[model samples]
Target: MDAKSSATDAKPAAVDAKTAAAVAAAEAAGPSTGESVRIDSWIWSVRLVKTRSIGATACRGGHVRVNGERVKPAYAVRVGDEVRLRHEGRERVVVVKRLIRKRVGAPVAVQCYIDNSPPPPPRETVAAAGIRDRGTGRPTKRDRREMERLRGLGAGPGGPSGGGFAAQGRPGDRDPSGGRGRPNGR
Candidate 1:
């Protein structure tokens, strides 16, 4: 009865109207496979990408290809079209088996395309790569030496010098007080 309650009730009606209109339009268009859909929308609908925005960004960045050629986001996708998407350092190759305008579940999404991507590369262990987790404190002298050795620096294995630093040590290593406290004087 209140204005706020009335407004809330009106909102759902508006949303329902919009949904009905969309359904009608889709019905008029007939089967999706018979009509071409935007490449970005198709990618998102088929779950090839996380979202339509990401698909659009990928297309704009030249990371999306259609039939072996780079294509814009608005490119029309039809049945049997080859779509190759390069994302996160990996390439996904899929051929359109069905066209869908709305996103579906993963199981259904998989049936929309024929995936031909290669197996992902083996994962490297953090310890093997000498990668330390954050907030673990700075590396110790031994850790530093090991890191430099892995990087082919220092005298551990491949380095020509004693270590990453010069043989005489750094400038900070010099006595700031001119060695006045020492018994020997030049």
Candidate 2:
């Protein structure tokens, strides 16, 4: 009964070698969405968005790009490749670290992607004409009523109900579609 030998023999030498080889292979591939990662899955794995659907939505919405051109979810992102993402009102650039096809943990997500470029300078922003920001921060009850009073969204196709689009509906509740009213505009 050799204690050291017994422990050593618990695992087959071949199994140990196989495990070591698998780990080495995974490490060689770098970070990925999972054991095997696709570009879209990898992006989802990296804490970029809350879900894979959001990542795909961003891509379909022209918010995701490879280099300078918009790419679809099927795009194969690899190490060193650049990815541009438009989130909220800002654009972010990231580099691929590894490809993982499955969802990953937060820490693992960080390893799957890299930041390659900084967002654009804010000074160059140009607010679209006719539309103006009433204010920032959460809207108070009074503020909501005031915004409704000064509704500024463009009008639906034909003329607005009583006034024009900007004049008739509330600022954030413009009825773009003919169906429904302001809040529930279809």
Candidate 3:
């Protein structure tokens, strides 16, 4: 009909042709597992790390390992390889189940790897243990002494009760020379 309508019709045909070509090429290439992807790219693709650059940084920092050996960012990764990443004070171990080049959604990304990480430590035990109230502010001198006593560092049972000259009494309170403050009867 109109020129605009004809142009739109031609665009879809071109896109379809490209899609068909891509599918045919993929079929010809056979299984995806036969090809290896870069470790940094794979890590980012599977959501193991936030960004490809971060993954590369981690690799360079010696925080990434493949099959128990540290590997560089450009290292090739294949299916069935075990990857260990140390991040945020915890270690994550995963087995690669699929290889993907582009980053994917969380669900699909998770499907690409088999997580073998140990369970994270309980939050209460880590962050809440001995935690004081919000408005408590800094500890007072008495609180410090009590805490030291609890840790067996203060003068208490099971700890060294005061040490040196201070343990007895003040200099004027007790005569260290054994004159009883009379100063040799003078």
lDDT of 3 by residue, 95-131 (tens): 9887778776665666678999999877777533235
Better model by lDDT: candidate 1 vs candidate 2: 1
Per-prediction tally of clashes: 0, 8, 0
Worst 10 residues of 2 by lDDT: 154-163
Model 2: per-residue Cα lDDT at residue 145: 46
Specify the highest-TM-score model's number: 1
Off by over 4 Å in 1: 1-34, 124-128, 132-137, 153-186
Candidate 2 lDDT, 1-186, residue by residue in tens:
699887778768766676556545545555534333455566776767768888888888999988778988877776777888887677778887666555555545565577765756676576444354666667775665455555655333344534555445666773466446545453
From the highest lDDT down, the ranking of the candidates is 1, 3, 2
Candidate achieving the largest lDDT: 1
The TM-score of candidate 3 is 0.55
Q: What is candidate 3's local distance difference test score?
A: 0.78
- Evaluated against the true structure, the overall lDDT of model 2 is 0.66
Q: Estimate each model's TM-score.
A: 0.62, 0.47, 0.55
lDDT of 1 by residue, 14-66 (tens): 97786666545544443543567899998998788898999999999999999
TM-score (C-alpha) between model 2 and the true structure: 0.47
